[model samples]
Target: MSIQNSIETKVKEGFLALYNTEIPTVEFQATRKEFEGDITVVVFPLLRYKKGNPVQIGEDLGKYIVENVTEITNYNVVKGFLNLVIDDSFYTNFFNAIYSDATYGFVSPKADEKAVMVEYSSPNTNKPLHLGHVRNNLLGYSVAEIIKAAGKKVYKTQIINDRGIHICKSMLAWEKFAPNGSDGQKETPENTGLKGDKLVGNYYVKFDQEYKKEIAQLIAEGKTEDEAKKEAPLFVEAQQMLLKWEAGDAEVVALWKEMNSWVYKGFEVTYKSMGVDFDTLYYESNTYLLGKDVVAQGLEKGVFYKKEDGSVWCDLTEDGLDEKIVLRSDGTAVYMTQDIGTAIQRVKDYADVGGMVYTVGNEQDYHFQVLFLILKKLGFDWAKQLHHLSYGMVDLPSGKMKSREGTVVDADDLMDEMTATAKEISEELGKLDGYSDKEKNELYETIGLGALKYFILKVDPKKRILFDPKSSVDFQGNTGPFIQYTYARIQSIIRKADFDYSQPLTIELHEKEKELLKQLELYPETVQQAAANYSPAIIANYTYDLVKEFNSFYQNVHILGEQDLNKKVFRVQLSKKVAETIKSAFLLLGIQVPERM
Candidate 1:
């Protein structure tokens, strides 16, 4: 049993035996720095059952614990707190048990565990992914991994917004302005030497530019702003194209398929480069028409009502929200309709999936609230398992990004910038003296991406981030490269150890060694807590703390030069375990660790 559990059990017995009163549980915290103990028990809480001064109560419990528990050798009472000093053998035994464990902090999912589907990076097809989508993807992928480590089955998935008026805007723009028209000069991704998504995205921007000019011209010709917007030739044509595409017009449908295929190809390359993947993919085009029949069913069941204009809505005013429209007057499904259908479709595809997590931006917090409530009102048993992992926006120093104006920070570009920064900093530090060019480049990418992922993942999801690539790649402080360098340092130590250090040994522990072991003991609990909170920042910060403890030990203790063979072996083993824990924690955050830097 863990020392905490042992102490708690013994303390309860002590209270019952001395005061003749039964206490259900005990509260414990890490002993204060100035206190001479390993763990502190707050005695003030037990005063409810035993009538006495807290300090006296603490003294009595401390005496009872030391007399009964073998692991706890000594104790000191400070006010109402009982500081228990555990024996060194406890720390050594704990270290020995986990020192060689390759997967110490992870749990294996049981055979019958229910699965969870995590949805993220649900990007519109009209534009390539930007900084916002980058955050979404990284957060979703990391959460999925953490959940798996916590012993749950997880499926990573995304829904592509492939069909809409926005997509038609890009198609219309390409047909009207491309050099060869749609059939004349085909601007295929391969020939243009651009990513498929980027190629399509250029046309989207072009459409906006021409649409604005037309709107301006119409306004100059004696039209109101709203009238000019609706009458603009480009806007009218795009609307017509959307209608035709929905009707399955042969020519329009063919073009839509061709363009979306290109975007999918480009998205694959980006997802691969970012080191995130999905087990399944859903497209809006296929799922948009769904939920309409469900609306009729809801109306029959009185879960929804028809408006005077024939629109369908769920009256949420009673639930502290305004009325939310599910379908338009013309029988067109709204975005919420598509999401409802997609969620149901996923459960159908994976029967074991009992819950879902939507990794969407905080802007849509209200949308998800309505979505979940609607699902529950529809009477689905699993509706209660739904969660919205709402995160804040990611902005750069240049300010917020707008996709239409082409001012957004592109994901590919940001990644490339990070790599360049990593290379620049690594060269100046002369850390690649003996590495080959290929090895150096690979290390640079690993460090660069690691920094990017870590910098973002380490912050609370509800908090906004102003990301600066330059500062993230720093070799010192709470950055990814700093933690990575410490891992490499430990690797160097292992390489220099000429004798076998894996044998078990018993010896008096140094304060630094005991401190490192204490930090290591928190890894499993950290993983579980991070999973429960659905936050990768917990794991990220825990890793930073562990690295800090290991560094303190490294500076104060000598491994290779120690005269005692047993002591040297134990220290090296401890260092190895610390590196292993770092690698494991980084894995949960979807970041890579370099063996050398």
Candidate 2:
């Protein structure tokens, strides 16, 4: 239950004395800054049921609420909107209730019973994870956490792209150039040798460069351009190698397994550093082929058709989407085919009532549009439950990150650079100068990751982001370190206070304390909205706002060492509640706050 629920209950009791039946949920919304009220009851949604004009019904409800509801000490009607001023004593009681309990700022009664499946971080084995993947992972992970906090059972899953022509290109490069991790310059801490994805990414580059060279030479020898590119043995070999691996050739399978494992090892470290973990892992190597059978079934059932070239396709033209191919002419599954199969597999494997996939890219909006349409056409009613949590791209100061130009922000490298940069900044601020190597490492990583996640998640999901690396890395303004610092400062104050805040509240708080508490009071509602809309940025924005408000309150007001005992006690309790609330919000966003950061 929430404060609004209690207010509504009292309003209903008054209305019941005057009417016959029950009132619906109250129209509770936060008031505008100009309105000298705590909440604005937009009773427009209820006027129809009252058998009167909007203004008349608004007046009746306003009187009914104020006369019976103790929470609203005074209220008035303005432009048919009921603006209610909550009693200052309500703040005193709110603190009293919160001081003895930890779960202060959330709704208790949960809605419905279905599960939410959140899919994210669907990276490929052929290349290193980039800044784009990092944003995707953070948003996806944070969304899952927020949904869970909203009292929904959420399943976090990752679909790894472990097979296909891309995977084989790297394998082929490794086979010819540096077989079995013995390139005579294998990766070591001191050496510049790359990890699995980077190593494989290098080969992907090599394959492209070498293939282009081979084509140029062939065209020079009088072969046609198309023929020169087509007959290039490197691509042909790579394709053949994929076919061989798909056919379960022992050596090819072994090499594929070896490469993907190395990639996993590298990815795991990054995931841990970012403080995210998946509940389930689905490999495309396994699911992509399975999708082929689903496509075949769909074709047989008239949900799809065979093109002139014998490729499997679905006509989504009715939905303004183009005809999409599910399988190649060679009877191999394409991206769509594999995805259809994976959807069915997850539904069966997890027994999930529904799913919410967070891919976090604007480019694939068309792809998911096709994906969900195809699933519905296949007669899976649960297809309606599928969602594409598409987020915008992370552009740099120059422009969009282009991989071929070698300007893409590699995830592992970005983490390293941010951590080092964080350490440098911390040292300059004298925040981590006397810290030991391990403590410095801890502070650097916590603050670095917090900065990265906040910068990426601060903007609304649909808006394209321009990340000026210089401007985003700063800790002085609306950054992650600022929030963490607020928490640290609160903790510092609490430690120095003579009174214990975990005890029951015994006094009325200050104006700033009451203000911070009011914001904290809406955490549950904020979380529920984020989960309902499938947007983690909402929670990110809320957490940052909460931190900012608390920080402002801390800077202006002295909590510890106050002259008045009541003021001192009140400040200490307020600081304690803010710290607890901040920590909880940070955890919901998959961010960790250093005890001292």
Task: Give the winner by lDDT.
Answer: 1
What would the per-residue lDDT of candidate 1 be over residues 275-315, giving only the tens digit for each residue?
99999988888888878888898899888999999999999
- Lowest lDDT block of 10, candidate 1: 178-187
Where is model 2 more than 4 Å wrong at Cα? 6-36, 42-60, 78-81, 103-112, 179-193, 223-225, 299-301, 305-312, 327-330
lDDT of 2: 0.77
TM-score of each: 0.96, 0.88
Question: For model 1, what is the C-alpha lDDT against the true structure?
Answer: 0.92
How many clashes in candidate 2? Answer: 0
Give one digit per residue, the lDDT tens place, for model 2 in 244-329: 99789999999898888878877887787777899889987777677877877898899889989998788878888898988889
